[model samples]
Structures are given as C-alpha cells and as structure tokens.
Target: MKIIKLNAIDSTNSFLKEMGQNSTLKNFTVVVTNNQEKGRGQVENKWISKPFKNLTFSVFTKDFDLEIKDQKYLNFAISLAIFNTLSNYKTPNLSIKWPNDILSANKKICGILIENNIKGTKITSSIIGIGLNVNQEKFADSLKNATSLKNSTNSKYDYDLDDLLLEIIENLKNTIHLLSLKKYQELETGYLNVLYKKNIPSMFKDRNDVLFMGKIIGISLYGNLQVELEDEIVKEFGLKEISFA
Candidate 1:
C-alpha cells in the first residue's frame, strides 16, 4: 500500500482517478488529504469538513478479475476496517449503517463512497473514498445529523493519525484478500452484526420519494438492502433504489 498525502485537494477520489488514468498505478495506491476542499459522496452529495480536522482519503484498487458478487464485500471490508479502528477507543457503540455509512449512536461518524470504473461486468479499477469525522468538534448547522469521534468520546482520542491509518489499511488489505478467496459467509455475518439499523423499524425512502418504515433484514450477497417493509413485503434495494432517512 502506498500513501500519497496531499496538503490539499478538491477531492482525493478525483485526484486518484486522474492518477489512475495516466499511470500504471497498481491496486491499493492511496491518495489522502489533510483537508479536502470539495469532497463528494454518493449521488454527488457534498461532504463538508473543517480543514485537517477529519479523515479523508481514497483507495485506488485494481479489481478487474473479481466477480460482481465479491465486489460489494470490498465495501464491507472498508466498513469493518473503520469499525475495528474506532473500537480501539473502546466505543462499542460504533456501527456500520446500511449501504455504507458509519454511525455513532444515531449520528453519522463516517461515510464510505465506492465508485467503480467498469467495463462490462468486470471492474477495471475502483476508488473507495472514505470521509470519517474523526477529530472535529462542531458541525455546521446543516450537518446537525453529523457527529465526530470527539463528540462520541466526550474528549479527544490521543492517537497518532498515521498509526490509525496504518491499522485501517492493513485490515482493509486482509479483508479484500479474504473476500477474493470467497469466504463470504464470514464477511456477511460480521457486517450484519454491526449494522446500525439492523432489525429496527426505521424510515427509508424509495425511488418515488415516498417514505416507508421497514426493518433491515440484513444485506444480501449482492450488497442490496433486504428490508421487510410495512404490509410484510420484503424488498431488496441496491445503492440507487433505497435511501436512508
């Protein structure tokens, strides 16, 4: 794993994609930023942050030969890595929200955005971007739903940033390798156990912008949200279909 620490960037994913386009940047090449000026998330949602006060980076992965079923496990791996690292704070309350969000209590602590460059059913490469609210204290008015590690711990964690990142990368590497080997049952169990809204009747939006209440049955092998909705209709949702409340 190679880490490229940028002093500043519009978004680490964009930077890494630019790099991947030009060079033979192998899998696991990383582009990180102390401050991301214009970070983005799924559906082009803006990610706001205070400079140098959060964990923001992108991992460039070469996954050309991976089966489509194995691709979503990569998302699981990233969530697991963050969960494990945050566990060092002894906050067992940390959780993986369905479809790639990390939350503490009910507030967002991290967001994972997986973008792929694909040809047919195969992925040529993927940029897994993560923006974790690590050291921030105050959130903007619009981000009242956002919370940081400092908010969870009630005090700052005294840990080296580099060391924590190393831990995450190491876990991530092992996770992808494990999934590539097809040990998916283990991954699914761990992910479901830590899912934030798992088995809870909560609100989610459909493609029509209508809100409905459902319990998360767990994520599927293809990484869709398996939700048991009102009136007992069990539905599955991909990234484009279901949205969180």
Candidate 2:
C-alpha cells in the first residue's frame, strides 16, 4: 500500500513501470499525480485531463497468480471496483462501458489502461492506470462526450480528489482479492450486472466505418465484446474493431 504523490509527471504508469523494473515494489504500490503531461488510454489513445482537477494515477501489483487466459478477469475486477466506489457517491446511471471505461448518464467519466508483464504463460505483474474526471467543469470541443464528477453531480457537493483516490484504491484492493481467489464467476456476474447498454438495442460502428445495430449480450472468455446482431448472429469484437455509435 505504498502511495507516491507527485505534483507533475509525464505518466504515472510509465514512472511506476520504470521504478518496478529497477527495484522491488510492494504489492499495491500506487503512483498518483496532480498533473499528468502525457497520459494515455488503451491502445495509445491520449487521455487529457485538467491539472489538479482530476484523478490520474496508476497502481502496480504483482499479487495475482493468473494465467494468460484469465487476464480479462483483471479488467472485470478493476472496472467493478470503480463502478462500486462511484455508486457510493450516487453517480447517476453509473455503468461500465466495455473493456473498461466508466460512464455516468451515458457520458464518459473515467478511463482505465492496464499493462501486464508476462513471462511465458503467466502474468507476472500489472500496472493499472486510471484517469477519472473529477472537478473539472469544462472540456475541449472535441471531447463533447466527457463529463466530470462536479458536472455530473449536484453543484452542492464538494469533491475531493485525494479522498476519492483512497476510496477507489481500497475498493480495488478488495475486488482484486476476489481475482486472487479465482472467483471468476462472481467477478464476471458483477461486471455484467452493471454493464452499459446490455440487452438494449444500440448502434455500433466497425473499423470499416460501417454502422449496424446490435445488442451487447456478454463478454467472451478472452475479453472480446459479444454482440447479438441481426438474424440472431452473435459476434465477438476486439477493442479496435468496434465502437459505439
């Protein structure tokens, strides 16, 4: 539970990864920053956040004894943890957008990026990065779907980033414990229970930019999104292959 706080950093995930390679770090070691200069999301997508007005941090853990095939459970566990924590604050319509993004009222609020260190058939360690929009009130014109805790909740509530970070970390630790115990069914059920747009007809765009209608049924064992399309044909899509319309 070692926590390192920095005023600014290029990327918490990068910093922690370097530190872990050079020295032995305790499990659940965390690196948090008030200002992240080059934060990134899944697949090298840039993550932009207002300095001191959001939660941008990374957690380094080597406690999970997971096979390569069971890695998706980590995503399920972390997403559920953030979903559970935000639910306590009464974030309206909280749901986990597939793979790992937190949404409130259908607007993006948090993004998670997980980097796993693999050795042969097992995962040796993981660096989990989270960027949660908190008190920031405005977003760039291009980020029209982005929202923050302050904007999502009533104006009367004062959101503290430090408190929120600690709470999420605690929740994460508990959820991650479930993973270590191999409670795969429980974690998957929890994830699907609050999954966004589940069983509801929605539009999606594939990498080809072709639009289609489908319903998100469940995630595959390997973490691909399973969608039920026209004529009862169910398809599994990877992260880059599909996106919500």
Candidate 3:
C-alpha cells in the first residue's frame, strides 16, 4: 500500500509504470497528482481537469491470478468500486457507462483507463488509472457533457483529495479480494445491476455515425455490449463498435 504523491506529472499511469520498471512496487501501490499535465481516458481519449481541482491517480496491483479471457471482470470490479465510492458520496443517479465511464445524472463525472501486463495467458499486473471530476466548475465547450462533484451538488465544496483517495483504495482492496476469491458471479451480476441504460431504449451510433435506437440487454462474456434493436435483432458490439449518441 505504498502511496506516492506528486505535485504535478505528465501522467500518473506512465509514472507508475516507470516506477515499476525501476523497482518492485507492492500491490495496491498508488501514484496520485494534484496536477496531471496529460491525463488519459478510454480508447486514447484525453482526460482534462483543472489543476488541483480533481482526482487523478493510478493504482498498481499484482497477483490477480486472472486469465486473459476473463480480464473484463477486472474492469467490472474496478468500475463497481468507483461507482460505490461515488454513491457513498450521495451522487444521484450514479451509473456506469459501458467500458468504464461513470455518469452522474446522465452527465460524465469520471473516466478510467486500465492497462494490464500479461505473462503467458494470465494477467501479471494491472495499472488502473482514474480521473474523477471533483471541484472543477468549468469545462471546455468540447466537453459539454462533463460535470464535477461540486457542480453536481451545487456547492462551493473543497474536498481533501487524500481522503477520497483513501476511500477509493479501500473500495478497490475489497473488490480485488472478492475477485481473487473467485466471486465471479457476484461481481458480474452486481456490475450489470448498475449498468447505465440497461433495459432502456437509447440512441446509439455506429462508427459510421449511423444512429439507431436499442435497448441494452447485457454484456457478453467477451465484454462486448449486447443490444436488442426494434426488429428483435440482437448484436454484440465491442469497444469502438458502438457509442452513445
């Protein structure tokens, strides 16, 4: 449970990786920054936050004993952990968008990027990077959908980043233990229970920008999204195959 705090860094994930390369880091080792110069998001998207106004950190965990085929469960567990943490803060209508985006009342509040190091067919380690909007009040026009904890709660609140970090790490510890204990069914079912837009018809766009309406059925074993369309047609879409419109 080694924690490293940085005044500023290019990317906490990269920093943690370099640290791991230079020396052995214990499980649950964390690197947090008050100012992340270049934060990353899912699928190479950029995560933007005002300096010292949000949460940006990465966690290094090892000995998952997880097969490469079941890596989605790791994502599920981490997502659930973040969701639980936010819910504990009384964030209203918390839901996880597929593949690790946390939404609050349909507005984006958090983003996660998980990179795994594999040895043979099993995962040897995972670098879980998280960027949670906490106190930022203004967002670029390009990120019109983004919102923060203070904005959502409509308060001039100042949060102690270390306190929130502690809470998140605790949640991750519990979830990771469950994962190692082979509580697959419980974690997977719990993930689906909080899945955003589940069983509700919503607009989605294919990579070609063609829009269609579908209801999210469930996630496939391979971590693809299963959607049932108007003609009773069901299909599974992986990352970048589909997105909310």
lDDT of 3 by residue, 199-238 (tens): 9999999999999999999988889999999999999999
Candidate 2 — which residues are off by over 4 angstroms?
none
Q: Rank the candidates by TM-score, best first.
A: 2, 3, 1
lDDT of 1 at 224: 84
Candidate order by decreasing lDDT: 2, 3, 1
Clashes (candidate 3): 0
Tens digit per residue, CA lDDT, model 1, 24-103: 89778988889899999888888888877788889887754666656777677778878877887765378888777888
Q: Which candidate's TM-score is highest?
A: 2
Better-scoring candidate (lDDT), 2 or 3 = 2
- Displacement of the residue 53 alpha carbon in candidate 2, Å: 0.7
TM-scores of all candidate predictions against the true structure: 0.90, 0.98, 0.97
Evaluate all candidate structures by whole-model CA lDDT and list the values in order: 0.81, 0.94, 0.92
lDDT of 2 by residue, 167-240 (tens): 99999999999999999999999999999999999999999999999999999989999999987999999999
Whole-model lDDT, model 1: 0.81
lDDT of 3: 0.92
lDDT of 1 at 128: 88
